[model samples]
Target: MKTRKLTAADAEAYWELRLLALQDHPDAFSTSYEDAIKQEDPIGRVKGNLESPDAETYGIFKEGKIAGNATLRYETPVKLRHRADLVGVYLAPEIRGKGYGKMLITKMFQAARGRDGIEKINLAVADTNPAARHVYEQAGFKPFGVEEKALKMGDTYISEIHMTLVLEDDK
Candidate 1:
């Protein structure tokens, strides 16, 4: 498997994988595949990621197909400029056991570190995803709290684990 940053050319594949993820892991993501597919510009959404200015999207490929994606987006407002939101993380189910998840995350850290005022990275994960939680913990993300039953998936409720990785004070 190879890991690289996301480009506009990779959007269609990204869209397909995202749809697969939502279809398979309905409890894992907030967006529904039905809603996403309704977009008139699927690829444009990927292209527009570039306009985020302080954001980046990375992809992992297995045999030349997009198997996963990770992203970092920064808030530009003066008050929130120093914070970065880590989002859009997904890995193909067939390729889950491989080291790609760790690779994707390490790459996210590298990408997040490149921006100014991005003193930390923040993310939320489902409390049930132990593999993901382990990866985040190894990456230095400390749990802040749990939003109990934060996700209402069909007839059941799920909790979300909120965590953050503080960037080293370059001082």
Candidate 2:
């Protein structure tokens, strides 16, 4: 498997994988497949986001096809400039137990470290997903709180566990 930050040329592959993520794990993502498919110019949006100055979307390729993805977006407000948010994290079901999730997150952390002022990274995962929660905890993220009923999918509600990882202080 190969991993890299996606470029505009990879948007199509990224979009397809994103839809799969939303579809295959409806409860894990905040965006529903229906809402995602209805977005205007999704390919353009994906390209724009991948090329944005404040964020990057990374992809993992299996046999040259996008099989997993993650995104890290830096905060823009002056007061919040030291923080970055992780979202849209997903991996193909076939690849879930192979440590790709850990690798994807590690790459994100490395990217965050390369930024000028980022001192912390934050993410949210469904509390019901113990496997995902365990992955984040093993990566040194500490739970700051839980947002009750954070996501509503039909008649079911899922809580989100908010987590944060503070970078080492060298200042």
Candidate 3:
């Protein structure tokens, strides 16, 4: 597998994988597949986001196709500039349980540490997803809190466990 930061040229491939992620695992993301498809100029929006300076989206490619992706988004406010959020984390079902999730998260950590002021990276994982929670824990993320009933789908409610990884300057 190959891992790298995505660019504007990767918009289409990224969007395709993103939609698949939302469709396959509706509970994992905040955005619904129906809502995502309804968005206007989604490709253009993905392209713009890929080109943004405040965020870095990393992709893991297997057999020349995107197998997984995770994004590190830096806070824009001056006081919060030292913090970053790890979001939109998803790996293809076929590739799960094979260690790719941890690898992808490692890349996010590298990207976060490469930035000037980022001292910590935060992320939220659905409490229903033990696999994802285990991966985050193995990557050194500690739980800070939990958001009760963070998402509702149909008649079901899913809570999220908030996690954070503090970066050491020497690392």
**Better candidate by TM-score, 1 or 2:** 2
Model 3 scores a TM of: 0.97
lDDT of 2 by residue, 18-103 (tens): 99988888888889999999999999999999999999889988998899999999999999999999999989888898899999
Candidate 2: how large is its RMSD? 1.8
For residues 76-151, write the lDDT of model 3, one tens digit per residue. Answer: 9999999999999999988999999988998898898899999999999999999999999998899999999999
Model 1 residue 89 lDDT score: 87
Which residue runs does candidate 1 get wrong by more than 4 Å? 169-171
Stretches off by above 4 angstroms in model 2 are 169-171
Q: Report the error of model 3 at residue 25, Å.
A: 0.9
Give per-candidate clash totals.
Answer: 0, 0, 0
The number of the candidate with the highest TM-score is 3
What digit string (tens of lDDT, one per residue) describes model 1 on residues 55-131?
88888988999899888988888998888888878898888877778889988888877877678889999877888
Each model's lDDT = 0.83, 0.91, 0.94
What TM-score would you give candidate 1 relative to the actual structure? 0.91
Q: Which pairs of residues collide in model 2?
A: none
